[model samples]
Target: MAGHGDSFVDCGCSVVGQAGGEAAATAQRRVLARTASVCPVCLGPAPAERVAVGDAVLLVKRCPEHGEFSAPVWRGEPAFTGWVRPKIPTARRGPGTERALGCPNDCGLCPDHGQHTCTLLIEVTQRCNLRCPVCFASAGQGGGRAKGLEGLGGELGGRPGDERHEGDTRASRREDDPTLGELVARLAVLRPRAGDANIQLSGGEPTLRDDLPQLITAVRGLGYPFVQLNTNGLRLAREKGYAARLAAAGLDSVFLQFDGPDDAATARLRGLPLHADKVRAVEACAAAGLGVVLVCTVARGVNDHCLGDIVRFGLARVPVVRGAHFQPVSFFGRYEGFGAPSGASESAPGVATAGTDDRADDRKLDDLREAARITLPEVMRAVRDQTGGLIPLAHLHPPGCEHAQCSFSGTFMAHEDGRLEPAGGACCGTGGSGGAARDAGTGGMAPEPIPAALGAERARSFVRRQWRAPDPATVSADTDGARGGTLATPPRDDFERFLARAGRRFSVSGMAFQDAWTLDTERLRGCCIHVAAPDGRMVPFCAWNLTSVDGRPLHRNGAPSRTGVAGCGGLGSGEGAGA
Candidate 1:
């Protein structure tokens, strides 16, 4: 009865819904509509339809060469059809490519592509220290296969791609990694076009690069409003000064890979008992004035149960731990299995792409169903159940910049006793000089979906004001030495004091990336997260990770060209790219 027209709720204004009872009944019976898709097996174009299966929506399509396929794209109470946010169409221009290869291949934000760039993900390397059972990037030792080594698969035990020869280590892969100058130039390209786009430094552990601080400083100098570091936090825990160096270099946020709260969860996902180390990493970041967003790769039977606990943990940390982001596993890259076996030992076969029983381990993307994966509605339901219903359904808002069904966000105010209240409407606390319309509280109403132009500024402000944690001096003394970091600092400055007052409010948000099986061109048209490619073009993040049936990645264009930097020499970022 309290329903209102807002981003979170669809007004009963649809032509069919508002039509006569007879018309409405007929509309309800209409279960199929056309869309577009890609065959997971061949990565070929396929005509698709949205078929209503009970309350869930299934994308059913057929490829000339790959046969028929269907995957669950949406589900839950209201039905997927009614969950769409009003479309906000931006100006469309011709794509950078000549339109030779079509929808995905014309990926230089091709003319047919629907959206402008929102968040630019700049991958710095293909090397990683740890090898996980499920890795989308296939990031491990030896720069993840040579330039064009495709179709190398067998089973667990051998190298990542199951290549006969041992791949290059992190040290051996440095020459191909993007340099600071090249990254700066890439950002320069986005400045005039995308305009103040948020840049996230990602790849086989961005922190592994010793010159990260230098890179962060370089990124900031180029006038990018927000610079985020995506890392596993292993380096942050071991190197006490690492977080501080990043902060001093103008790093705005750390997207830390936090699978769950226990050592077992860490070992299952990351192949090590990293719970203690994750905590230390959070503490180090908090002490050094860096905001952290816990990024949990949510596997259904894996660490999905810990979603609520992860949110509570983040709320307890307040301004420092800004949010917890949950990503339902999208079967892409080198992912081997759906869920880890119970009591998975350290020596247990990982979910690597190189599994011998390829059919048993690798999910044929074409055969994927709604039951095979977790959906956003399911995740929200789990979070609500975990928190005892304190997290209101209305608090989840349709994304302002991305596809409505792609993601949802909720903002909350943290209490000293660990209770979290939705920060909107009647409960929204008094605020400062910031815009009240954009305030956390709007009477529990969802904020209107914003266009790309406005979304960028709003994103920058949110990261600066809400993501940055409160001054350490104002935190409860009981949390001291909890993470064992040496970057603690004395509180100083009026700005810090002012931010402390506004820091209690933080946000929880996530985006479900579409893999090849769920590749809908409609969703692609609305994508805002773009991966910066070496060809000086921006490819949608999902498209970049989408792989062909033969295991060839769509947009992984290799390392960008270096500018005036010295040749890649010396022992770079000491993490061995060994499995």
Candidate 2:
């Protein structure tokens, strides 16, 4: 009744839809104009054709000024518990550096993961209130103790990672247990980059610490850029203003663990119906003005059906909700009964590199692919359809990812309302590069600037406020100068690349859905760094993982054990390394 313009706008305005002008059809698509769809960035009624025909995923939008831009498909409003709301009026960048991961072969920057090891996260405790089975930290395996596993260190068996403290068990283990003030003092010695360096306080449950807020205050006093907590929402929801208290104490944001709407799935993952609790926690975080990046450990056949539901949940939270991040169950650390029979996992479709590899008991990146059983792009497509095209791959997609598409986990799609787009969607990590955007990162979108569409005010506002780094570049190199240390490059491939290759080796994919997908050659050469000093900084141009990154088997994804390898032989932070 209104006009074709109304129809285009109703479709949520493709990036090229707003500007109704001549040549507005975009040579990119107007060049193939048999029929025009809708575009927002370039204005209405633009020659915007769908990329993946039957996919129903509005992949790209053609804009005359912007050429073509990524677009997400939106579904509808989300369905989360009524109480939740956003805390921060606007989303702030979460923890971690803009350019954290590095480029393999020394592409450009100053190697050592671009930003260098400015901030290194240390998990003091692997204990938690809930036994989330999906937790790679293996909180479920513990007996609800305050620290890590009881006597048995590492996984359920084998030698503990950091056993230096193990001997301290006799006569009041105080020296081995570094207090917050003590930890901060040790951190001070690290001499993190002046203003750029940061410190993330992660654990089985950092909030579980009786003196968390106080310790956070101390960490803040250390002049850290921001302090973040990785937690499962128990104390956050129950303790009113808990998040705000930490925020005021210099806590930046929270990496909250959240799945989707499936109460059953939540129960399975958390060993309890945490759906309502998680919602309450989000609301509490919002009320506290704390930014949140919903973290989900995506597992095929587990809660995959709830992908759309997850995005919807995040979006409804509005401003406080920055975005959702997905971490396809990395088969590292302590996750026990979570993967497939083969014990491998993959990222979502189009996102996964290859399939998981056999012969790997724990943390074989290759084996993770087999476990994930999906590609990165395919997951991106699902996210787009679920979110109703509001969140595009480029907007929330990964940057320089192996594939053009990023796994839904590391990305957060933005929408006009200022709240996150596809709020309730799920997330996880993995790779894919069958040729999509081709420039997004492992946890970010392509380096390209976001289009000035949506609203001139809103668009400009976002570019100025939300964008974290101008160019999120990755720095990597061999730095072998022919140095020594079990550091052997992967034969034809170096360690980082080889590991990345292993990361994607096994997995499932395609509508045909085989057990494998494509792998990003660059990611395979896993970035390697040698901890040269006790400051927690990684030596530049170091070789990738030659023998083992952390420990092998039981202690592979080692957390700092007071008496583990981290603390053994005075090897800088040795005890802290083997959690």
Candidate 3:
């Protein structure tokens, strides 16, 4: 970030471009030749199409049927905030595209996850009670070298026989190890100070874990403060007081997988009919006074017809069902060989893409901006209508962006109406696209213009920040002894100091979390910074060695990050059924 001075490149269409990807000259050619003119949702010409505005090509798309969205570009700017914010490139993994390859697939952000990220995506378990086709967790499988609690625990650099964390060049983790303390200690290290640390409790149905309550208690015991659970609803719907029991276990909310109503949606998405049960689960949670965040994976072909309906469902349950996150199908685990039909006369840019439904490969970052037909302000206006109320888009200014132009990052909003106003929705890699602002003191900042170069990369870094794939080099021998990655540890005194700055004090109510939201992530990421433990295991809440982008210091999880963490469930509470 220091020696490099090549900030903005000339989209060359006019002024120089920012430090993102290609400039206007290249972007225009890509969209005109490879992109389409219709809205990916309704298959109609995007509303307010903003094409070629100086070095940028803005696209403002709104649909009465689908959600509202906007993409703007100004390739002619200098580097993103002159090193104040820089993109952290994701390491290419064993098998995956070079990223930046999905945007062309649709009008959404880069399928490479153009935006949004949760530094820590705590999936309590890869096991689920119900087996659904589109289940993102890809859970509900049997044993036999399964990566269960230990797999999860090792994420924090502590999993049992956890010797690899020692940092010994020769030290490494074994194949199987399950220790809870190492995980707890690690979480204590990663727990964000100001913002709630996100912990998504997933499962072969966490309720199935007889030790579910104890696990929840363990996470609560740790100072997580915020917790969320992802479930199929079998336990909560059928079992009476199931939700109550979980609430009593110190659960904050549930990111229930409610695709649609009736068995139709359930069958289509889950490959089984359980709509009734799904509704029951939602109701049960509401009855138990637990916040509910509906999780829907918007498949282009599978449940294409239900997009609008899902929004309405969330709107109807507003306030109680805080919000809903829509993830366009990701081609992973179970979705590996999946394919979506592109035969529709007027389909999205890359409708026919296989196993890439989630990545916007149909539309590249350049294409999305070129196809920009909607604006944040405009999208908000439409959202207000869909929600049957005024969901002023202004309410959703990309809260924690890494760029000056709010749009350069992704889009996100702090909306009360159950749907994300986040930079981009989870669907089509939405959350981290727009780089809007929020008050610095109160988590609000004024909207700024976007620079081209920083747009895609900034968004990528955001997603990487949220990606769950830990470094294999860091795990092993912590809680669940298993071969894994290497991680750093946090200082104890600094951890305490960070917590104090976050205004987080335990309430006698026995609740560890209360009103956590994405305010200033820079000030909250302290929780994620950590030091390598004596044994080389990654520590969770250790709190030392954590510093801000500028060494200013930040709390963990910021407000917006908190929502994803809490909604996914079981984050703050790391223990799953096995725990």
> Each candidate's lDDT (Cα)?
0.60, 0.38, 0.35
Model 1 regions lying over 4 Å from their true place? 1-32, 92-95, 142-161, 164-172, 339-372, 425-452, 471-501, 558-579
Best candidate per TM-score, number?
1
Once model 2 is optimally superposed onto the true structure by TM-score, how far is the C-alpha of residue 297 displaced, in angstroms? 1.1
- TM-scores of all models? 0.76, 0.49, 0.43
RMSD in angstroms, candidate 3?
A: 19.3
lDDT of 1 by residue, 1-579 (tens): 001111011111123434465465345534468877765544556677776644566666665543566566666742455444544557433335545445655566766665666578888776566656566676655222222212112111334455411111222155667787887798777666566667899886676577889988888888877889888787788876878989999898888999897876777666667788889889889778888889888766778788889888787676678888888877666554442221122222221223445433323322222223777877777887888876755566565566767876777777667777776521111111111222334333333444544543455555556565555555433343442112244336776544444566767776688886677877887787788776678888887787544344555643211220012121111121100
* Per-residue accuracy of model 2 over 221-320 as CA lDDT, tens digit each: 7666556677877788877767778867867667777877757777655656767778877777766656666776666566666667776665554345
Q: How do these models rank on lDDT, best leading?
A: 1, 2, 3
- Kindly list the per-residue Cα lDDT of model 3 for residues 1-579, writing each as its tens digit: 000122121212432354543474344532311122222232222233334545344333333333333334323222122212233322211221222211111111112322222223343343444445443323444221222233222221223442211111211122212234554565555443212334555443556555667777788887655556767676788778868888888877677777665567666666657777777776776566566666665443455455446555644543235455544343222222132212112333232334344234433422322222222233332334544543333233332322222222122322323444333342112232222222212343323333322333343343323222222222221212111112244324654433222211100000000001101111212122122232322222212111111111111212102222212221222111100
CA lDDT of 10 in candidate 3? 20
Better of 2 and 3 by TM-score: 2
Measured on C-alpha atoms, candidate 2 has an lDDT of: 0.38
lDDT of 1 at 235: 79
